[model samples]
Target: MQRFTVTLVWVCFTLATFPAQAEELALTSTRTLAASCAACHGPNGNSLGSTPTLAALNQQYFIQRMQGFKDGSVSSTVMHHHAKGLTTEEVTAMAAYFAQQPRQTPQPLPHQSFLGAQ
Candidate 1:
């Protein structure tokens, strides 16, 4: 009984000291890192961007996009540059950050928005 109790106690202590599955930045840190990104990505992931706004996207979708960027499937001069530098952990954090942000409401087109123009 005494040996069993010591073993259990050590096991618990070791588990407590174990590292994370992967490093993940806190949301606050992600936000701080995102300040520069906000210049183009927009505050809270809502960009004043002429390209596309990325605010409030699903976490999975955001992760897919980041992975795409990392794989060179996604095209963007700036995104490529930035994405290349992101560690997988950082990418996950950034994705989580944007996922938590509010999405921007899309504006209706004034003219006919056609799928195809003849």
Candidate 2:
């Protein structure tokens, strides 16, 4: 029937749009939580210099480290305190967000040579 076909199309359209909206909401939630780390970890987990980069770190490793920090198994001047503030679900979301980020390739250090004369 025409009505049945129209109903099926409407259902499919609604279902397709729901996932995109859900994904956007999840991303927003993750970003909101990750924003707290921006000062040290850089935007989206890419560190600038001296600080260790978190971008593209494996999800399991990130989760494990965060859990360790939260539990006092890992020692850091600030991370432990910060980690303790996040819930397990928030930690998982943070890990997933950072793991999805693209990592910057390390630039090779420049070499220098000195001689009195050549």
The residue ranges of model 1 lying beyond 4 angstroms of the native Cα positions read 1-25, 104-118
Query: What is the model-wide C-alpha lDDT for candidate 2?
Result: 0.86
After superposition, which runs of candidate 2 have C-alpha atoms over 4 Å from their true positions? 1-20, 105-118
For residues 1-25, write the lDDT of model 1, one tens digit per residue.
Answer: 9999999999988777554322333
Cα deviation at 42, candidate 2, in Å, is: 1.4
Model 1, residue 34: distance off in Å is 1.8
Worst 10 residues of 1 by lDDT: 18-27
**What is candidate 1's TM-score against the reference?**
0.61
> Model 2: what TM-score?
0.69
For the record, the alpha-carbon RMSD of candidate 1 to the native fold, in angstroms, is 12.0
lDDT of 2 by residue, 10-92 (tens): 99999999999999998898888787786887766777777778888999999999899989988878889888988999989
- Clashing residue pairs, candidate 1? none
